[model samples]
Target: MDPRLTLVVISSCIALCLGCTKELSVGELFYGSVIETKSSPSAKHCQILCTYELRCAIFTFSNFKCELKRDDSGAIRAVSSSIISGRSLFSCAAEKKEACFRDEYSQVAFKDKPYQTVRTTNEKECRSKCDNDPLCSFYTFYKSSAQCELKFWNLLPTAEVLYSSTGNLVSGYSSKLKLNINAKYNCLSIQSKGYLLENDYFDYTYSGAAFTVEHCQTLCNLNPFCRVYAYRTNGHCRLKLIKDSHTQGAKLDYVISGLRQTDCKPNFVGKKTTATT
Candidate 1:
């Protein structure tokens, strides 16, 4: 989430519970290095925009100009303003939201092949894409190339940090801790019909009636007892109610086995059933 957008969302939620104003005061600012600048409508919007940015430690807005700065070394505060200055509450709120921790290294990238690749407009969007993918542990984004590489491994291949002279590449890792904003169901990754598993027995069989793999996965997600499932092309969806049932390297060509990656395991005894034509 964008920090300014995040603040806006939080403020809205807080307003619903308790009526509050848009005023947010962090503290008096000093000299800082300007990271980026954007046109802002109001002082509050500028504050929110600054708070929304990860690197923006402090910001000031005047005459529709918002200057976001990085104040890690405390040098950006030579001049302070009370009319349009605010501090960032992102770190504090990030803990509550379980936001992904980021570490950016300029001109650095992983040498090994990435498990996945996606295109994004900015580094922030690229990082967010990696955060959403369960398999992605780290990622690299090149501004000039416009390529986002999502890697499965946490560590870089070479001990030496990759460097770029032009300073177009930025790389980082995802914290993996994510907030389950979706209250209904925690769905797993969906694979094609070619993917199948062995040793996993389905406890119950349901007539899918021309249901797709997506539909069967949804059904499994909704049912508490379902842990794994197998969906056939003929609309036979089998829901497994046991953990560790999926044996590695067990492949059934006709059945598509879908595994649920949840912390909760089924305890009740399940009866085996066959699909009826």
Candidate 2:
């Protein structure tokens, strides 16, 4: 099972009973982050945009005015709306409603033999425990048993098998992935500020990826449509689009093959780098 499948309990049971319901609607206030914050109302407008965007788990309105930010991960909300706040959608029913975490998933995993049971207070704490232990990668929390389970291996069982506590048990796998590459590799010769010898990879996220001369060459070689490529020792990855594909092993601007593959052991990238995963 994926570490994100674990369930966390909230301590707000008592709080939920005492507090009056403060329901939220599509147009209601949703706390979010202002990806760009040059002005005050930018955050508020962002909130509106978030409301329009489906699949948006939640949003934060903060930073002087209201900043609209997306929270699909449903993990942590390191946001500041200067005002608006929210509890996890999973925790909306807790007695303390907004005071406890109620995410169905946690970032925890097993280490030794039979996976041990866990009882985390929230998703964050569950993940924190797994992260602290390098041996962990994924976790499963039984909603009924209120137990968190961890994993140390790579296994993907069906939902039927996973949720079936014998019938409804949660099951997941470690996110850590070990990659092995063929020797005929693509490599970049690094100068100051560049990867001593590195390669770049982009999951197609607009940004958050970097490349090097050698890395660019390797990327092109591995990819078909890599007619031209560029690299910056700036520690940031940038890939350009070329009309061509299948440009086999051509060197351009210090680009070359022989670069070693960097093992991506998902340890903290969130999507697939949590140390336990």
Candidate 3:
């Protein structure tokens, strides 16, 4: 009855569909490339810096170099000369694609740190958290544990497709760089009084609280800027102020002790991964 109106509606619908489409691709290595590089204690540290850079999808770093690239299409490959090994970083940050994109997953981006433990919610909140933090590069959240881990690369495989229980745990796109630099060093590591020297310090202590050393470490790890930690039977987590003495506190469920450390590494490197697909 209204042929002209129907025709106009169909044309508009087609335009909308065409407006929202994108193509996707896959390969052995992904993200992009390392357009940059810097000196770091280890390859991981270098990777960390590269991951922080916008458009730094993947990189290869050595004592002398760091490389970044882009991979939207093709069976691309990278040949290396300097870096021992390099890989991509992980990401869970989603993108709002136009409606024409067929894949539902294509629209969602993941986030990965200063990652607050995963709570039930949407990517917007997670991204908001990351965006606010100057240090956060990307993030990934686990559906099972509801744990969110922040990341460096453009990708965040916070969703572990394949994983090993122990040995070397690589995230979605992470690999240790086989740099000429020393492996014992990284951007961050744990420090205790015994590990380094002390000059100035502060300690806030509590008592009669029971906790395991393991539990104490978890608390410290969770803290945003927790450099080191000490726990005793007194149920206290000494967020200590340390100096040149090189002393570290303790972690015990029911023991009494002080906390301090020296000679601790510069940054903490509990674990890391690059987001390559």
lDDT of 1 by residue, 1-277 (tens): 3343343344334323432223444344434667677754445556555544444566666645677765634343434443466555443442233333345667766565887788999889888998788666568899997899987532111112354677898877665533221122333364545565655544454434223454455456534456667787555667766656545635566677776645521111111123322
Q: What number of clashing residue pairs does each candidate have, in the order they appear?
A: 11, 56, 90
| Candidate with better TM-score, 2 vs 3 | 2
> Local distance difference test, per candidate?
0.53, 0.32, 0.33
Task: Work out how many backbone clashes candidate 2 has.
Answer: 56
* Residue 265 accuracy (lDDT) in model 1: 18
**Model 1 residue 218 distance off true place after TM-score fit, in angstroms:** 28
Model 3 CA lDDT for position 206: 21
Sort the predicted structures by lDDT, highest score first.
1, 3, 2
Residue 103 in candidate 1 has what lDDT? 56
TM-score against truth, every candidate: 0.31, 0.23, 0.22
Between 1 and 3, whose TM-score is larger? 1
- Superposition error at 44 for model 1 (Å): 34
User: What C-alpha lDDT, on a 0 to 100 scale, does residue 218 get in candidate 3?
Assistant: 37
Candidate 3 residue 98 Cα shift, in angstroms, is: 31
